[model samples]
Target: MSSTTRRRFQHPAALIGAAVLAASITACGSSDTTSATSPATSAPAPASASAAAGVLTVRDPWVKAADKGMTAAFATIVNDGDTDVTITGVSTDVSRAEIHEMAMADGKMTMRQKQGGVVVAARSQVALEPGGDHLMLMDLTRPVRAGDQLDVTLTFADGRTQTFTTVAKPFTGAQESYAPGHGASPAS
Candidate 1:
């Protein structure tokens, strides 16, 4: 083969190899980064709020701030033991906390304050969703941002009380789930 011809073939071959090497390096870097950060970026599982030694496990707790300085939080409560638990009362920095429900009435959503409070069956779970049953943080002193947490106290029907902090999130039009005895009980 002529020297010039050999030179042309070598240059093109080297260019192609460099291109392949660059593509491979980019692909490897992206995969490593995604794998390294995937777990941390994924949603958190759940956290628990304990009673006077009472355990209340909470999942995906989310709160929506209202323009009138009120906010609502919805979540699932799990009783991880044999004994049933009751959440009778709630308190927050906002105006008094209460169990409230958003229901459809006359083609409009209406909010009703609940007085019966919530009960988690023994070894069972209760979900507090939007539109049906949820927590009302009245007269919020501060805005509940996406990454913020709200500290609340929950009282039981047996006069046993438990306080815990809950993470706040924006509501996504989820219907609130209802359980018997789930509402804001009369404050003592």
Candidate 2:
């Protein structure tokens, strides 16, 4: 073969090999960077208020703030045991706290005490939220504000009680209305 022809083939082959090596290096570098930074870049899960019992767990317990009148507390009760559990009552440091239900009565929305307590089925969960079944806090000794914390206690059917610390957050979302002032008559 002519020397010139051999030179042409060698040059092309070397160039091709170099190109392939460069591409492979770039890909490896990018993959390493992604893997190294994944944990730092990814966000952590939002913290939730929780209390644990032998057979029960409560999550995301929170209270709505009221100037000086009435507000509500919500939580999720998870029953992990094989037997059902009934949440008989709720008590808070405020003046009064009770388990209340919002329902349509006589073609009007009425809020009243829930009879027989709230039952969490075995291996299931019950969520107490606004406009549904929740704990009503009335006659507050003082005003509640955002970022404040309160201690609430729950009474179970089996004579077991669990106390949870809940954070107070100002919520302006609409809820089931009471007859007159919706029980939030904003301090006289």
- TM-score per candidate: 0.59, 0.67
In candidate 2, what are the lDDT values of residues 67-149, reduced to their tens digit?
Answer: 77677887677787788999888888875777888777777766778888899999898988877888888778898776677
The lDDT for every candidate, in the order shown, is 0.60, 0.67
Candidate 1 structure lDDT: 0.60
- Candidate 1 lDDT by residue in tens digits, 15-39: 7786666545432432212232121
TM-score of 2: 0.67
- Which model scores highest in lDDT? 2
**What's the residue-level lDDT of 103 in candidate 1?**
58
